[model samples]
Target: MKIFPIPCLEDNYAYLIIDESSGEAAVVDPVEPEKVLKVANDNGVSTVKLVLTTHHHWDHARGNEKMKELVPGVRVLGGSFDNVHGCTDRLEHGDKISLGRDVNILALHTPCHTKGHICYFVTGKEEEDPAVFTGDTLFVAGCGKFFEGTAEQMYQSLCMILRPLPKQTRVYCDHEYTEKNLRFALFVEPENEHIKRKLLWAKHQREANQPTVPSSIEEELYINPFMRVDMPEVQKRVGRSSAVEALMELRRMKDNWTR
Candidate 1:
């Protein structure tokens, strides 16, 4: 199994997950149908399936209708509240969808940034390099804002929904916000050497016009202060005791943060 990162419009990222053995592929949050189609054609892969969206966000669901037009009878899977352009499967928490012989997609209801936000975990594959397509719930150095839910929901989603995943799981977020997020991480945790190193690496990657996603959960746990709101250092910086309170403070800071 291999994942291709397709950057689109501003900062949105669309992923193309291909099963090498069967040549079957699934598009995760296709931002543009033309790009996805071009890549699929160039790679000699067939788009027989698609994982539509985690929510109704325009950037994430915009290309679904057109992609459906290009690939007739493509199965589109998404959360119930997504209202995807060409959705065929209405997935809920704990639902599993088979991708190939042993590859399967496990839906995790991680609603906080949005009421219907869901992340997909690809499992039962070779290489043991499992991946999670977290639309906006989790990022390389940060998480999404609390748009329709509270910090409590965010904490539950991260601690309960996402944190338990394998430490080596590669997180494929739906945006190219690593450089910016790492910058903010540096601001929040100036003494964190891990964040400093990651920021330096991200700076070079962005300078070279490269993607910085597929960050491991272990890396996030180490450097993402938002994910470490329970720690003493983060609590001291945010002046919050509980993880949820610290998260809220961090989010409020990011709301005011600007590049």
Candidate 2:
């Protein structure tokens, strides 16, 4: 399986997951149809079999209809309650979708940024390592705002559902917010060498016009503040004992934080 990260509006990203064996592809959160189609064609993918939407946000699912119009019989999949535009298939937690002979994607219902947001976990015979396409629910060093759910819900979504994944699992989130997120992480843990080193690395990547995504779960465990809510420094910074309280305070701090 091959994953191509297509940059969309501003910092948003739309991924193209291709099955090399059959040259079939699936797009995740295609904000723009033309860009995704162009990438697909460039990579020799003749058919787009599926359009997987992580949420109903315009920047994520706006191009669903246009993509379907272009692909003819492409299936649009989203959370059961998302009511995403152009969604033909309603998926619940643990629902599996096969892309080709080698690639299979499992939908994980992780609602926080939106009421019905879901992340796709891709694993198959062709992949060297598994990957999770965490739309806006999880970022490289930060997380999405609680637009529709509470801090506790976000905690469960990140810590319970995502944290347990293999350390080498690559996280393909939907935005390029790594640098800014690392800045906040530094504030939360000023002495953390991991956060400092990652921030510097992200800066270099941005300077070279490279994408700073596809961060491994191991990297996130070391640098991401949201994932480290239980750490002594993070708990002390937030002045909270419980993970939920720490997460709540951290989210609030991030909202008003500025570099």
Candidate 3:
């Protein structure tokens, strides 16, 4: 499986997952149909079999109808929620959707950013390592704001669902918020040299007009503050007893933090 991160409106990202042997592809959270089509054409993939939406946010699911129009018979799959427009197939937790003969996308219902948000875990024949399309639920060094759920929900979503993925599983989140998130991570753990180094690397990547996404779960475990709410240092800094409480405090701080 080949993954292409297509940069869309400002910092948002939409991914294109291609099955190399069959040349069939699936697009995740397409904000713009033309951009996705162009990328598919450039990669010599003419058949787009599926359109997977992570959430109903405009920046993520706006191009669903247009994409369907562009590519006839493309199955639009998303969470089993009312707000997801153009969703022909409603997916739930643990549901596996097959792409071509080898690629399988497992839907994980991680609802914190939205009540019905879901992340796609991709594993297949040609992939060297599995990958997860986290949408806005999980970022490189941060997680999304709890727009529809509480801290407990977010904590469960991050720790129980996402954190347990294989160490090498690549996280393909839907934004370029790494540098800013690392700044917050540094504030949460001032002595963490790993966070400092990652911030510097993200700065250089941005300076070179490159993307700092597709971070591994292993890297996130070391540098992402959201993933460290259960750690002693993080809990102490947040002055919280439980993981959920620490996550709440950290989220509040992040919401009010200035770069």
Candidate 1 per-residue C-alpha lDDT over 26-104 given as tens digits, one digit per residue, 9 for 90 to 100: 8888869889777777786755566547766888888888877888888878887556667788889998887756678
Residue pairs in collision within model 2: none
Candidate 2 structure quality by residue, lDDT tens digits, 12-94: 99999998889999999999999999999999996999999999999999999999899999999999978699999999999
Residue 126 displacement (Å), model 1: 3.8
TM-score to true structure, per model: 0.96, 0.98, 0.98
The candidate, 1 or 2, that scores higher on lDDT is 2
- lDDT, model 1, position 202: 91
Candidate 3's residue-wise lDDT over 1-259, tens digit each? 8999999999999999998878899999999889998999999895999999999999999999999899999999999852887999999999999998778999999988999999999997754799999999999999999999999889888999999999999999999999999999999999999999999999999999999989999999999989999898899998998889999999999999997
Give candidate 1's TM-score: 0.96
Off by over 4 Å in 3: none
Model 1, runs deviating above 4 Å: none
Model 1: lDDT equals 0.84
Clashing pairs in 1: none
